[model samples]
Structures are given as C-alpha cells and as structure tokens.
Target: MKEMEPWWKRSVVYQIYPRSFMDSNGDGVGDLQGIISKMDYLKKLGIGIIWLSPVYDSPNDDNGYDIRDYQTIMQEFGTMQDFEQLIEEAKQRDIRIVMDLVVNHTSDEHAWFVESRSSKDSNYRDYYIWRDGKGAQPPNNWGSIFSGPAWEKDELTDSYYLHLFSKKQPDLNWEHGPLRNNIFDMMTFWLEKGIGGFRMDVINFISKDEKLPDGEIHHEQGYGDGSTYFMNGPKIHTYLREMNEKVLSRYDVLTVGEMPGASTEDARIYTNPENQEVNMIFTFEHMNLDSGPNEKWDVRPLELVALKRNLEKWQHALHEVGWNSLYWNNHDQPRVVSRFGEDGAFREVSAKMLAICLHMLQGTPYIYQGEELGMTNVKFDSLSEYRDIETLNMYKEKRQQGIAHETIMSSIYAKGRDNARTPMQWTSNGGFTTGTPWIRMNTNTSFINAEQAIADPSSIFYTYQRLIQLRKIHAIITHGSFQLLLPDHPDLFVYKRQTAEEEWLIVNNFSEKTNQLVWKECNLPQTKGNIMIANYDSPKLEGDMVEVRPYESFVIAFERGK
Candidate 1:
C-alpha cells in the first residue's frame, strides 16, 4: 500500500469571484448555478480545488467580504439548496470547494451586531469591540482601511465600536470565549456539509491589541499607521491553536489564511505543520513590490529585481517550515498581465511567461477567474464608472486635496480593486450575464475572452493547463528544493528546482527587450538542455550566453526521471 499525502499538496486552486464569474438567471450577478455551469471548464483546466469567494449572506458593503450570516447563502447568489447543489456537483468532478471564511468581521446588520448595538447590557454586547470615547474624541486615532476613522460611535450606548475596515463591517472581539465557540461551530457545520476546506480572510487580524492605543506616524513616509496593533497581534497564534483544536484538526480540510503585513518569520509559524495553525498563507509582500512605501494607491512601476527578491525571500523562507499560496491576481488585485507583464502587443506571450514564473515555484498555485485567459486591467474614463469603496474614497479625498483628475485616475487604473472586480469575459460581449453586469466589463474582452483562448492551443489557457498537469506528474515540482539561479538578474527571473534525483532550470525574461543571460558565474551547465515547456517557439540557449526573447519563459529538464 502507498502512503497518502495531503490531497491539497498536489492540487491547484481556482478562485471564483461569484459576482463576476457567470450569471444563470440573467440577474447581472453571478450565482451558485452559474458556477455549476462552469464545472466542466474548471475540470478541463485541471484545477483540483475551487476557492469560492464569499456567497454568504451580505449587504455588499465590500462586495461579499462583509458577511451578515454564516450559513445562509446570499439571495442574489441563490438559496441554500443551490449552494448544496454546487458542492455536490463540484465534488463529482474531483474538485473540492474551499469557502472564503470572513470571520475577522461581520456586517453591522448581523444579529449579533444588531443585539450588541441595541443595548450595552445585551448578551451579545461583548461580541464586538466597543470603547468609551476619550472625552469628546474617538478612543484612538485609528483609521479604517476603507478610509477615515476606524471607530463608529453608537448613540444608543455612547460608545465607539472598532472597525478595522468599513464602518458597516464591525470587528469581532476574539477575546470573547463565546464568540470563539460560535466561530468554531460555524466551521464544523460547513465541514459536516461536505465542503473540502476554507480560505480564511485576514485571520491574523482577528486578535487586536487590548490597549487600543493611538496610531503612530509612518517612519519613511508621513501618514497615520493603524495596522500595527491588529496585524499578527499578540494573541493570534493562541487563537489559531484554539481554533485548530476546536475545529480544523478533526477534518482533513485544506486551510489557507490570507495574512497581510505578515513577515516571513510570522508565516513560518502560522503555517508550520507542527504548530497546527493553517496549511499555508497568502503573503502580500510580492504584491506590494509595485506600490510606494506610503500606500497601496501610490502606484510605482515594479522593478523586475524587486519582484524577484520578494518572491525568492518567501520561497526560501517557507522551503523547510511552511507552504506558500502562489498567486499573481485575485479578486482584490489588478490583473497580472497589466501589473507585471506586457499587456500590449505581447499580451499572450507575457501572460504565459508570468504563469511559468509563478507555477514553477514550490507552492500551491492559484488561478483567479479569467486569469488563464490572460485578462488585462480596465481603465475607465470617469469616477462614475467605478464602484469600489476604496477607489471612490481615494478619488474624493485626493480631489478635495486639489489633485488633478488624471493623476487620481492613473492610480485607479494601476492599483484600484475594481480592475479585478470587472465581469468575467466569456464572449466578445461578455457572456457573463444576459442582463447588464453589476460592474463594468474589461473592454479588451473583445479579443481576450475565454471563448477565444480555449479555441487556441497556443493560448495562455493551455499553458496553465499544461502547468497544472506537470505538477501532478513531476514529483520534483511538488516537493523540490528551490534555488534562485541569477539572484541579481535585472530582466531575467531564473531559478532551479531540484529533488534528490531530478533538476529543472526555469528561466523567465520579464522585459520586452531581449536579455542576455550569463549563468557561467552561477556554475550552471553550458550545454543546452531539452525544453519541457515554453511560451516562444524554438527558444535558443546556445553555449554560455543565452539570449532570452521578449517575455519568453521555459523549463529545461537537465535531469528527469532518473
């Protein structure tokens, strides 16, 4: 008999942003049945897991991130029966459903919050963080992630409630034992329903510093910084351990925590198997490489070296201790082709190159909806066209500060979350819905739809499909030791993945200009090896100096099946 490894270890996860994926009833909002309609497409793409973004009951404050009920499905998304059908249908195709668990906060309309705000003496009053104001001012000068103050003063009790995000989404008090119990119960209920796993949303931010002190100014840039208190808080690991004991440990579910502001050292402990916290974590370090130090909206062109160093840091850090969730685009991020790759004349090749770069890493790869189709970011003409709360707030604030409309719109085009929220492009007209979409569609859908990609064998979709297949067949890819080949290469991202018997050299040219790669100093073989996969036809690697073409990437199998 063969020893069984964790199923999630070998699986590729495909994330579905329900609102944009597909709509079955022509309701303009993608729902459970819409996802079910695409099960065959996902299976054909070879993803073993589908990380479904929140379909839970919500008021759409931040899309579906703000939840009102744990078990109930959103009315726009359909009923509980539809959700059950989705799970059953997905499982039949060897695909497991990993729900987005947003326990860090809940909608203000949640029953617990409704009762907690009704009276200071209510049983649920302690469920959320509420503090008396400091005289006439807020208890602390904390700012919400969305914008402005983090605290909302309730007139009923004359107390200010902490909300790290939007005011309508109140932060839950993890210190409360009963609150913890309720969270555990919710997890058990889902697991018992036959769902495969959970993708925890900002799980690290659950435990906040009890003191709730005033925020300090940024060291490098002048700005108020409030993330210091709640990010990887004092009691986070303790709470995770308790959560593991109460819920996670009993089930063989794949657990991934979306941890922002988590250092490499912090992730090592959070995902280390022996610690019994989570299976892996999504690190934002790589994603922040393009942003200015002061803020995410402060967009700066990412240097290839910066991205290389950031990814190498995480790959090397978690090589022995934990697992990494590899991704370039998600519902909250701009499309990778637009952000990191060439989304112009070289869009297809560049998208394939980017896929090779991420898929070659020693981590579970995640493909966001339409990512396989090489989706590009949308640049809307006006603020009226945008719907994201963060982008709208930034535009309003910047305009108030006398910033030019072009300047703010440029930032919105580069880093706005709305870029990722656009309706999925299925056709030239965006067959996402029969009716108008909830958000604007990427106009590039005319040429970059999934319909066209699936028809072409040379498309980015096939490259991702082949990459997923490689993971299943090649043991070297799954558990191989990673070594950065050219640590300081300006335009080339080169690395080697090796097991005890096999070695593979993965080369990527991130620049539009052809780069000359000299791996002689690195002691790599001078001989050209067999190409396992590539974005370009007849890629040349002659003698010592290899010329990598514009947005080209390929894996050279020097040692295989030994």
Candidate 2:
C-alpha cells in the first residue's frame, strides 16, 4: 500500500497580495470583502490554499509587515468581522486561508512598544530589545535592511533599540519568557479562529545574540553585517519547538517559514518531521541566481546551467527528509515571466513554460496573483510613482553617491518588490478599483487582464488551472524522483520524474531561440511517449531528434523501462 501524505504537499497555493488584489469599496485598497467577492475565481483555479498577505492593523509601514496589533484587522482591510466572513466564504469552497505572520517585530506605535519605551521600569520594558548608546553613536554599526542604521535611539529612555528593517519597526526580545508566551497565546487566538496556518515572515530572525556585540563593518557602506548574530540564532529552534508544543501540535494545519539565507543543512533540521519546527521553508538561494554579491538590486544575467544546478541540489537535498515550497513569483519578487522568460513577444508562451517547469518539480506550487494572466513588470518613468520603502531608499542613497538616475532606475525596474505589487489587471481600467488605484496599473492590462485570460481557452490562466488539475491526478508529480538530463545544456532544461510504473520527461527551451536535440548525443532512451502538456499546440518528437520552438516545453509520460 502507498503511504499517505499531507494535504499541503499535494495542494497548490495561491498567494493574494491583498493591497492589490481588489477593492470592494472603491477605496483603492483590496479588502476582506474584495477577497470574499473573488472566492469563486480562486475556486475555479483549483488551489487548496490561499496564502493571504498581512491584514492585521498596521500603519502601512513596510506595507503591513510591521504589525501594530495581531488580532485586529487593519482599518484599510476592514474589521475582524469581515475577516471572519472571508474565512467562512473560503471554507465554503474548500479553500483554507493561511495568514502571513510577521512576529519578528512590531510597529513603534504599538501599545507594547509605547509602554516599553516610556521607561526602563515599565511592565512592558523588556518587550523589545533596548540597549544603551555608545557615547553618541548607536549601540553598534548594524545596518537596517532599508538602507540605514539598524539601531534607533529613543530619547525617552536615552537608549537605542534594534530594528532590522525599519526604524518604526522594533525587534522583539524573544529571550523574555513572557513575550514568548504572549506570542504563543496570540497564535492560539488565530488558530482557534480557524486559520489554516501561517506563512511566518523572517521567522528565523526572531532570536538574537544577547551580547549585542559589534560586527564586521563594510567601509563603502559604513554599516556592520549584523545578520550573523540574528539569522537562525541559538534560540530559534527552541522557540519554534515551544510554539509547536503549545499551539501548533493541537491544530492540523500547514506552516511555511520565509527564511532568508537558510542553508539545506538548516532546512534538514527545520522540516525533518521529527523536529517539527515547520512544514517547509522558502529559501533564497535560487531566487538570488540573477543577483550579485552586493544585494538583489545588483542585477545580473542568469545562467540557465547555474539555475539547474541550484534547483537540482535542493531537489535531492530534501528528497528524503524535508519538503520545498516551490515558487517563481511572490509578494516580494518581480514576475517570473518578465525576469526569466521572454516577456516581449512570447509573454503567454513563456509564462506557460515557466509554470510547467516549476510545477513539475517536487514541491508545493505557489501562484501569485496576476501570474496566471502573465503580468509583466512596470517601467514607471519616475521614482515619485514608487511607494516601496526599499526602492525609494535605494534611489535616494544611490543618487547622493553620484550614481546616474537611469542606472538606479534600471536596478529598480529589474528587482523592485513593487513589481509584484501592481494592482491585479481585472480589466483595461484595472477593475481592481472603480476609483483611483493605490498604485499605477500596468498599461498592458488592456490585453493581459484576467477578463481576457479567462475567456481564452489557450491563455496562461488555463495553463495554470490545468497544471493544478494534473498534479491532483498524477501521484508521480508528487512522489516521483527527479533527475536532470542535460546539466550542461545552455538553452534547454531537460529533466525526468520517475515512479515504479512510469517516467515523465519535461523538456523546456528557456531561451527565445529554437534548439534541436539529437537523441543520441545525451544517451537518452528513445521511447514512444504520451504528451501530457505543452506550451505550443503541436510539439511532435520525430524519430532521433526533438525540435522545440522558442520558449516551448512539454511533459511526455512513458512506461518505465520501456
């Protein structure tokens, strides 16, 4: 008999970046009601999970990652009642709602932070990490992720507090027992309310070095690399295990951690099943394939061979023990079609190619909003139109250092998080809102909207829908072993998934140029096969050679040992 697996492993996830999904009240913000309104649309896509981005009460600092309150819904998003209604609506369609949990830090305006900063002797004094300044400068030369010092001094207590992201977002002190208990209680509150699970944001950074020692400084940037002391810290595993014992073990739910810089060694322990820290984690190794050492903003051309090796490594690393969360686009990433595929002439074609290439891999697939419609990145002429804190800060810093505006804008165009935050193109006028949109809509919406995709049978939306359907029908997609066919192939990504009964060959042409595969060159077996899916209409494998068009891909299943 075959062993049973969890629902999440076999299920596809659809991530809804709420601020840009839809607006029910014409308020230019996507609300819970907007999500409720679109329930049927998500249902039609055949996804089992809807990973909703943060909707908790916030000042919109870092776009809701800085939570002011955990339980209350953001006024812009609507009330807790609306959220509850959303849960019921989603449940009716058999779709579970997984919330985005941002517990590493809280808004400076939060009640706990307010009280904690009032005095060193307050009841909430130890709620956050606060330290004394070194004479006039900060406690250390740590850098904020948004391009400044990580420490922000509070005049009230005459001390400095650590903030890994923004100054307004203060890092919590997990060393305090009470704070940990409070977090667990908050988690239980949500679990009881029927949330399926959590997508923990920077969850690995919750713990920190108590000594708060100075770190290695970079002279060019004049900031210390303090991530060494915080990321995957000493107490992180203990804290997560405690969370599992207290809150998670009671509920049957899915949990995925957005862990930056997580190595496969760390993942083996995190998702080893015996440890039970989390169900899976999103690693950045593959995501950084197109970036250089400075940052993700330091854009570079991606070599297809490097990508194959990186993903193949992860596939084998976790094949036996851990699970991987497969995704090409997310709330914080540029659309994959634009970044990796030919978004100009072969937009939809390449979109389908990317979807099949990733969905065939061994992992739970995630489809970001507008990805199904093959949304392209925006090239806004000026920086004033940008709302992302990271983009704005980078532009300002680079300009001050005498960098050309065009050069900085080029980086932003290639890698800005806002690229994924564009309002969903429901229509030519952006049916996302009747009134003004929170951000500018992509001009391509005229032809690339959901209304168009859903109407056309050969659209990217149907490609994704079919991909999800195929996953449900084929156990080979979930449990089959993966093998890279041509690791040195420059333009082709050839791989196979095998089971006891069959093998599936997935060949993708990642470039715009057509490639000819002479069967004998790779020593691959020449077998009569069944085409499961393909981007092009007719992709026939003539004897001894397979000619794939630009961005063409297909999966052909054949009997094992044929």
User: Best by TM-score, which number?
Assistant: 2
lDDT of 1 by residue, 1-562 (tens): 9568788878999999999999999979999999999899999999999999999999998998989999999999999999899999998999999999999999999999999999989999999999999999888888777877899999989999999899999999999999999999999999999899999999999989999878886543233577889999999999999999999899999999999999999999998999999999999988998888878888988898888888888989999688988999998999999999989999999999999999999989999999999988999887899999888887887887888999989889999998988988988878899988888788888898888888998999999999999999988888999888777778889999988777788989998999887757545554446788999986675776778999999998775453
- Misplaced by over 4 Å in model 2 are 1-3, 520-527
Per-structure clash totals for the candidates: 0, 0
Candidate 2 lDDT over residue span 1-562, tens digit each: 8666888988999999999999999989889999999999999989999999999999987999989999899999999999999999999999999999898999998999999999999999899999998899998889998888999989988999999999999999999999999999999999899989999999999989888777788545789988889999989999999999999999999999999978989998898888989999999998999998768888999899999999998898888798999999998999999999989999989999999999999989999999999998999987888999989998888888899998999999999999999899988767999888898888888898988888899999999999999999999999899999889999999899989888888989999998997766544445777889999986856787888899999998888666
- State residue 398's C-alpha deviation in candidate 2, in Å: 1.0
Give me the displacement of residue 517 in model 2, in angstroms: 1.6
Stretches of model 1 off by over 4 angstroms after superposition: 1-3, 219-223, 519-522, 525-528, 560-562
Q: Which ten residues in a row have the lowest lDDT in candidate 1?
A: 217-226
Worst 10 residues of 2 by lDDT: 519-528
